[model samples]
Target: MNLLLLEDGDFTAADQVRLSGRRLAHMQEIQQVAVGDSLRVGRINGLMGHGEVTALTSSHAELSVQLSTPPPAKLPLTLLLAMPRPKMFRRILQHCATLGVPEIILLNSYRVEKSFWQTPFLQPAVVRENLLLGLEQARDTVLPKVRIEKRFKPFVEDQLPGLINNQLALVAHPGDYPACPRGIDQPLTLAIGPEGGWIPYEVDKLIEAGMQPVQLGERILRVETAVTALLARLY
Candidate 1:
């Protein structure tokens, strides 16, 4: 973990935090922290700073924290992603968080398996766990807002147009369309389809909802790779 993330429960006092479990193990084994040593630290949805190890033992540790620096700026983007397979869901969620996606809409597509929505990875606690790992990797504190939309047609027809209003909206699909824009300095609302890409009807519906179709080339990338590539190319 690049940044030691502390939750509200960890705080024993305004300036002090007690650590155990994975964090303590990381300190004892990976970080090998000692009394009087300082480590990078941040609070969830809060500030970034450092903590000085004041007390340590095999089971737990205590640190005094001072937070002043704000977390890195989040991308001005809202990601609408078709729910991926269970095996790849966690990694994709982490990638979204690490990439600074401020909002995520877990959408349903024709090719998406019904079982994908039932995966335990979609559980609130499990989702937060994966997001935390991503934040730690990126040294960020703010958690991205995640929403689920099971019905594709209704969401696109009723809600999407307003969501994309005044924003540069695009759908990443495999087709004969304009290339995805690069290094654009504007807020974006992007939709990425399922494994096999959006069907024609879905693409048409998205276009009607104010998104223009764009392609990343003839190569078909996996959902995770495509998400990273699209976000990187946009910002």
Candidate 2:
């Protein structure tokens, strides 16, 4: 773990934390942290800081923390993505967090399978777990907000306009449309399709909802690969 992600419950005092389970094992096995050693730490949705190890045991580790640094800045981007399959869902969610996407909309598209929505990964607890893993990987304390939109038309027609307001919006597609812009210093709203890509009807609706179509060249990529690639290019 790049950062020791601490929860509210992990705090035993205002400035001290007690950690067990995976974190404890990670400290003992991977980090091999010793008493008086300082390690990078962050409170969830809070601040980045360092903790000095005060005590350690087989079960738990105690550290005194002082948070003085702010978390990393998030991209001023809202990602709209078709629901990926269960195998790719967790990875994509983690990628979103790692890439500093502040907001995400798990949208529905014509080519998305009905079974994809039924995955256990969509459960609130599971989603949070994956997002946390991403945050830990990126050394970020702020959690990315994930929203679900099971109905495509209503969400696209009713809610998308409000989200796209005054922002640069783009939809990733297969066509030879304008190349995806790079390193722009503007708020962005990007929509990516599913594995087989958005059917024509879905693409048209998204276009009508204010997202301009863009492309990432002729090579097709998986949903997870596309998400990381697009976010990297945009930022």
Candidate 3:
């Protein structure tokens, strides 16, 4: 894991969490961490800090931590994604976390198959696993929040506004708008459509809801590639 993430109660002592429970091998193998080495650590939803490895063994390890500050501010973007199929869903979750979007909402689109939502990848544990892997790769400890919206109009009309206040909003479509802006440092709410893209009715609804329609390019892109490409361009 990048920065060892622990909840307030996860720590056994002042700074140590019981690694054997979830991440013993990660420490022992991937990191090859040694006693006396200081590692980056953070309490979930809390401060970032340093932990000194106090002890290490085959089964467990101990750390003495001192936290004084939080990790870097998360990317000020919210992703509204039409649920992709199960396989792509896994990769997208990790990509979202890795790119540092703090919130992700997976919604149903007209083209989205009803059966896709039944996939095991939607299970909370599976989603969290992918997010954690992303955090580990990014060397950050904060977890992004994920929300599912099985309905379309009710969510877009009733709920999206509050989350989008004062944010530059864009919807990724293949046609009918200027190029997606580059180097967008402002907070953004980016909506990416399904494989077949948002149907005309859905696009019009989103546009009426204050989303600025933007095209990635003439060539259609898959949901996974489009998401990463859009985020990279915005960054």
The runs of at least 3 residues in candidate 1 whose Cα sits more than 4 Å from the true structure, single-residue gaps closed, are none
Give the alpha carbon lDDT tens digit for every residue of 175-214 in model 2: 9699998998899999999999999998899899999999
lDDT of each: 0.95, 0.94, 0.86
| Candidate 2 residue pairs in backbone clash | none
User: Which window of 10 residues has the lowest lDDT sum in candidate 3?
Assistant: 15-24
Q: Of the candidates numbered 2 and 3, which has the greater TM-score value?
A: 2
Q: Sort all candidates by TM-score, best to worst.
A: 1, 2, 3
Work out the TM-score per prediction: 0.98, 0.98, 0.91
Candidate 2: give its CA RMSD in angstroms. Answer: 0.8
lDDT-superior candidate, 1 or 3: 1
Candidate 3: list runs displaced more than 4 Å. none
Top lDDT model = 1
Error of 3 at 11 (Å): 0.8
